[model samples]
Target: VCPEDSNDSSRFMDLWYTFVDPYATEVDEMGTDEANKSVGVLRIKDGRKIIDAYEWKHDNDVHLLAQNDELIIYELHVGDFHEKFKDLTTKIEHFKSLGINASNINSYFFF
Candidate 1:
């Protein structure tokens, strides 16, 4: 669809939207209905478009560098570790005793 086809070029915009079609490579959140998703782009290395079919592949796990193996990693759950700074301070000695040189935590959705 084009703006000129709409008969009001100034007010009309040529908008394109994708839906959960059979040709979709993958669906976000596994939505089955058309209105709930957007399709991935299908194209060739030479810029040719794929119109009839799509091949879906699951993402592969990324392999970390060799240096990653050398690091001492201590995984911790921040919310479970402590409720406040004072509480955390009380565990400093315990943490030090663990002899862990590094720590990683994910607390973004802890509510």
Candidate 2:
């Protein structure tokens, strides 16, 4: 499976490609593999080097603190926590463990 080891068929540089129809139903219309049909990263297989930068990393240091109307509030839909009283109590304790306020996200994920 080594390209450089065997020095097999000669290779040449080719143009990077994408398709108007991503699925590529016709022979003329080329497309990516089914697994790469959606938005994600592309890489060079040899050294696991990333050549495509579709999505960039987010800045983790940014924080926003607002007052009154400027401040955004979040309401969590606590379903499983609402089921058992002990779960709600434990969930509250878990939320308090985090420095900032957190939500109960175990309830519904739509999955």
Candidate 3:
């Protein structure tokens, strides 16, 4: 549903039905048993296929930036930040509430 190629329509539909749909049921069925988990497979019309599937759990304590050490040193774009947050003051407040340290905000710099 996220604007994939029209050539792989059937594959996309299968992916949506297999993985996206009944996500809760799949997660519940899998539970804490990693070995018993059913991995979703995607088969393209061109014969290329992918088997790995990932689920993002909503954990408020886990920050996206803190997930990987590589992300810590990376600088985020100002325009993207503004577009994502909408308001500067509210964004700053949110960051503070999330225990993010104050850093110099450079909004004028373009990538």
Highest TM-score against the true fold, candidate: 1
lDDT of each: 0.58, 0.50, 0.48
Per residue, candidate 1 scores C-alpha lDDT tens digits across 1-111 of 345457754673456565555755444554476555555544455676455455556568675543666666677665675556466567767766876555676673666
Clashing pairs in 2: none
Better of 2 and 3 by lDDT: 2
TM per candidate comes to: 0.33, 0.22, 0.24
Scored by lDDT, model 2 comes in at 0.50
Model 3 residue 87 CA deviation in Å: 1.6
Candidate ranking (TM-score, best to worst)? 1, 3, 2
Candidate 1 has what TM-score? 0.33
> What digit string (tens of lDDT, one per residue) describes model 3 on residues 3-93?
5546655443333223433322233344345544555333455675443366666766654444443332323445656555356555666
Best by lDDT: 1
Worst 10 residues of 1 by lDDT: 36-45
> Is 1 or 2 the stronger prediction by TM-score?
1
**Roughly what TM-score does model 2 have, to 2 decimal places?**
0.22
lDDT of 3 at 49: 47
lDDT of 2 by residue, 1-111 (tens): 346766766665566554344432223322377533444333456776544435656767676565455533345655655666566667565555554343334545556
